[model samples]
Target: MEVDLGEPQMLAIGQLADRTGLSVSAIRFYEARGLVTALRNRGGQRRFLRSEIRRLSFILIAQQLGFTLGQIREQLAALPQGRAPTQQDWARISRSFRNSLDERIDGLVRLRDRLDGCIGCGCLSLRKCALYNPDDRLGRLGPGPRLLLGDAPSEPAISPAAAIGSS
Candidate 1:
């Protein structure tokens, strides 16, 4: 985002790929998706603004953080194309991700914490796990890994000794 008018104002597609470490096809894909734009020179060759490097960098980070391309495109559209984004602009854009980021983190945490517990599906074949679920009780919540779907276990798993005399 540093404005160095000293460098060329526009760069060729190959130069953009080199500077951004993206393949030519990837850069072209981004353009097709409207995440970046290219202009045609007199020879009909594609040229891109130097600022597109920063834009591509943002796209890379957003994808790494599990954002869908559509979501990244929406966020990038908020940035003004006439100039480089100021720090304040970035802050505002970051704020927009806060709720979504928190939700994503929460889901990951839930999966991490609950994945070991029996989901009442008996998939693990652990007959006496403390979190053992019986009779597909977790299925009452719905299909598709109900425990992972946020359904709580019906009870703490019964101890094996306690289960032995009960039939």
Candidate 2:
């Protein structure tokens, strides 16, 4: 259902949970984490704006996409508070989020391409492992598959000819 933004529609905590498909505890947790806000009614009951449904939905989607709570919070911070976000507001945040997702997708593709070969596995078993970290030399570059983690080698670690010959 489309929310009438001009209406002063307030949802009880239970209603908000029902609308967002989130458990009451989960909604409270998100509220505590600053992802959502709740206002106290005259009876001291928590109330949420109808717009919170969209915010909670976005949170769920972002989490599914592997965004951390902090990252999701940063994105949601772009949205207006205490009011329904306008289309332009959502558009701006989505454009920023799309860039992040695109970068992650590119990294995944690069990882897939390298999976057939060494992938900076640090095994040093291959004759010409591009990320040959013999004796853990790349350990100085930090932990876990430095090359695969986007660390650059001082020189071209493997020539195109060598990479082809290895396969």
Candidate 3:
């Protein structure tokens, strides 16, 4: 139930939840995390500004895009506290976040292209591993899927048939 109380542009917590499609507890959690703020009514009930709808919506979208809560908080921090975020403020944050999203997309593309090849785990048990990794020399570079992580394979590439014949 929304408690209007004749307030101008202020929404009760439940009203905010309905508008943002978030549970009241979830809104409270965001508040505690400093992502949102609430004003107390005369009955000491939580009231959020109407502008919070957009803010919470942004939070939802950013979280779905793989942003951490801390990163969302930092982005929200760049906006003015007492007013609704302007288009310019959101654009500035988007410019900063775009670089990070681009890098992640590039990494996913790399992983997809190299997934069929040896990951440079240094085991050298697989036929492809013998050709790409060659006695686990990549282990000296570092651990954990070196080739997938953008590390070049130490040995020259060979056809799968040649590798299988050697095995």
Top TM-score: which candidate number? 3
Per-residue lDDT of model 3, residues 92-161, tens digit only: 9889888988878878888888777677887676777877887788888988888877888655667767
Badly placed stretches (over 4 Å) of model 3 are 1-8, 154-167
lDDT of each: 0.78, 0.82, 0.84
How does model 2 fare in lDDT? 0.82
Question: 36-143 in candidate 1: lDDT tens per residue?
Answer: 988898999998878889999999988988999999998888887746677888788889978988888877887888666554454645543334556666666677
Where does candidate 2 stray beyond 4 Å?
1-5, 126-143, 151-166
Give a tens-digit lDDT track for model 2, residues 43-121.
9999998889999999998898799999999999999898888899999998999989998887888788776655465
The residue pairs found clashing in candidate 1 are none
Q: Is candidate 1 or candidate 3 better by lDDT?
A: 3
When sorted by TM-score, best at the front, the candidate numbers are: 3, 2, 1
Q: TM-score: which is higher, 1 or 2?
A: 2
lDDT sort, best first:
3, 2, 1
